[model samples]
Target: MSEDGARDDGRQQRQELGSFLRRQRERLDRTAYGLPPAGRGRAVGLRREEVSYLSGVSVTWYTWLEQGRDINPSRQVLDAVATTLRLTDAEHDYVLSLVGLAPRPATRADAVDIAPAQVQRFLDALDEHPAYALAPDWGIAGWNKAYERLYPGVATTAGENRNLLWLVFTDPSVRSLLDDWDDTSRRFLAEFRAEAGPRLSDPRYRDLISRLRAASVDFDTRWNEHGVGGFVSRERVFRHPELGRLVFEHHQLRPSDHLDLQLVVYVADAETRRRFARTKD
Candidate 1:
């Protein structure tokens, strides 16, 4: 392509990005988030100024962005903007593509299937252990009966509500099942930060953050602290109201054929193994 054509393409991308951002902001109910309309005048959607305030950018910078100026936004800045606009994971990636910063998603014609069902069967085979699979974005892609028996309904949330982080932060049942809620939540977030480093700007990560912030003040604190931890498999003890202290050593495994999937398995202690046997009764 000629230099002029290239420049035109770039300009077109910016325009598209600005338009996408406007739609996302306008569609979001300010009242739902407890923030008044942020744009100047009676603008239909969130104002550029509102976005700037929330995204930690100067009004001028944000204005330039919405005005379709040929400016490059960093990943962190894009992440903040996506969060402020409340974009979904898919939409977040779309905005990046508009800026020529990310590759466009493959069309269904060319796209392969996401998670496979066999993964669930594999989890089932680890009958003694609680096992589940997480998608690249950390949604529960699949789980064995053992996992469901332990963290019931966690990996099996119907529809779009099937996110592991969402369950961890928002679900009261899941919360009550934890032995140390605060410690466990923080560790999950830290591991998330580590796993999500390259994908910080992606809508999937931003959407999870937004939901967690809305649901848990503790999540808000730890996220803002910017702590990161390695994703080492560790032990956990879930204190059930009736089941008492159930101990297990959990570890993560990646399927060789599916790089985007993570398999998590939990090995129980002797007592917990016995408890597992009885629970099946």
Candidate 2:
């Protein structure tokens, strides 16, 4: 067989895998929802039309999906389908795995746990720069006093939902803080989608998604596109109420043994650092 032919065969195998996984998920959904069994049934579980309606996808597309036609679905589309089918967290992870996406590790929840003492010490150590610990889903797990002083909105809004993705996409204050709002929003949304695939069944995850979908059209659009990329580096210009436009280098760290909790440190440039020092005076 030719190399091209071999590649085609591999693609076909993946599609077949996706279709089988979808069917199994549909079966689980039917049983969970107490839907009728396949008693001489033409099709098991949900009809393609029903699944399409629930997922906001075209019936033809869904049909192609079930037929394993090498459809490259966006994370948003997969997420919609997962929601419609009421898939469990494990099932959602399996769906992502079938499509060759990063599956959320089984140890995520345990990995996110940061001891109170560690969190306190970490915050205390960040003497001047703003820094915070975020949960896997970007919720504010903990932060330094300097963070609150630098970003007062964090104190008031952090309680609302500590998720940085949700804030960038939905909050007006966050938009005002960043110079290029659109690009920042897109990058954050893509990162959120990638991180969220593993935790789809978490109530907090669903709630955050629902809120963002209702609040931001741009977020809703990018979310459905299923763009995936890990958080490598983010350069943000924060228009601090006291310090003015301060640029910070944002880094995402996975320190937990399970790789769930993310430690986001904001380091200021020399100018920004000087400004921060003057702000104290």
Candidate 3:
């Protein structure tokens, strides 16, 4: 985008953000915060100064934000404001996006979208464990037989729909397999947003987000909340159709040569191992 276009976009975003904040503030009840009722012709909502006092910001800075000035806002300030206004997760994220404070990707973006043959071979070697490779954009680039067996949808999901975030939100099979669907889906969205920070404006990223918002209400709501978090290894439980209840440790690895490619693996526990062994017999 051209510098002029960038400036124009920024101005519009700020204006919209300001309008949203003002509307949310105006909708609040003054008495709810222990303030007196509206006097005479005063508006019902809390005053700008009251908001500033409650949010720990200067009156001038808060006014500038509501007025859509060119001033920048830090994440801490925004969080404080959100708390003062009792904004929902989606509302908070919307405000952050306007100010460009969403979390950025921690990894380098030099890896290719397609997994190399060697990478596929490595995944194939994990015969008893479910493993898959993720591209820089979180697209499923490769998977092993174990992963396919665990969730058959991966092999059948068409292009664009093959994304991990898309599947987590839109795929019924995946939703059913996860023991904690609500928490897992939300966390996945947060992690995906963290990785997508630098690419938020990219056409591909926008398209994927747009498609997801249109396809699933759950995804759209979570996206608006703008939750973001770093990935961490944790125990995952899946109620497999064939294996009953399976427990495994979910881990992610980034190869030194392919920093953009993330390898997700599920290592089985003893009970899960015995179950798999029984199935083989």
Candidate 4:
């Protein structure tokens, strides 16, 4: 890369870092930090001084940091600021990448759009349990017959509409399938936000968010809240139209060779296994 190109890239990274920090800071309630809430007309987030004080950084330096001024913040300082803002694991890594403290994540463009044959075979080998592969942007790249049976829409949803987050929010069938749509949807949104990180500004991410905001009132409301969380493997309950009530442990894995692709699987217990077997018969 040319010297000029490197400079431009650094500038963009700083700007994105500043914006991300500001958003995270603003979304937090001052009261949660044992500080008084912002009064009527004041800005909603913690003031710069408050953050600096909490982070033990100089207020002037912190203000400059938010302004995207040409400055280098030490890893320790960044860590303190991230802690003060309660950034998640992914968010912290993103902040590090912005300042050349961590390696940048691979872009979706570098990844393949379809699941590898080996991955598809693995899904197929899952037998009755439903399993699917998710591309970097949460696109439903591939799935097994069991997954198709679990969510028939996956087999039919085409183009941009094939994204998991899009389906979770916009598909009425998904709402009907999940036993706890409100909680499940919110959790999914939070996880997506955390995973998206610096790529939130990418065109595809922006387009998806805009469409969801326009399509679902729930998504719009929750999105404005700026909630972020890491993914957790847990028991998920579903009310299948034909299968009735089903229980499974929702889990996800990343292939060593294809780190960007996520393999999401639903592992069934004995009762759920019997239910799946009955459907097969």
lDDT of 2: 0.72
Candidate 1, overall lDDT? 0.77
lDDT of 1 by residue, 1-281 (tens): 99999999999989888777777777766666667545453324666677789889898987777778999988778888988888876778887777767743332121122358677778878987898888766777777777778887764577466777778887888888988888888888888777777776677667767878988887788889998997777789897776789999979898877757888898999998888888783
Candidate with better TM-score, 2 vs 3: 3
Q: Whose lDDT is higher: candidate 1's or candidate 2's?
A: 1
TM-scores, all models, native as reference: 0.58, 0.58, 0.60, 0.63
What candidate 4 gets wrong by more than 4 Å, as runs, is 1-101, 106-112
Model 1 stretches with alpha carbons more than 4 Å out: 1-114
Residue pairs in candidate 3 whose N, alpha carbon or C atoms collide under 3 angstroms: 89-225, 90-224, 90-225
Position 216, candidate 1: lDDT: 82
Winner on TM-score between 2 and 4 is 4
Better of 1 and 3 by lDDT: 3
Q: Which is superior by lDDT, 2 or 4?
A: 4
Off by over 4 Å in 3: 1-113, 278-281
Candidate 4 lDDT, 191-235, residue by residue in tens: 888888768767777788899999999999999999999889999
What CA root-mean-square deviation does each model show from the true structure?
14.4, 11.7, 18.9, 17.8
Clashes by residue pair, model 4: none
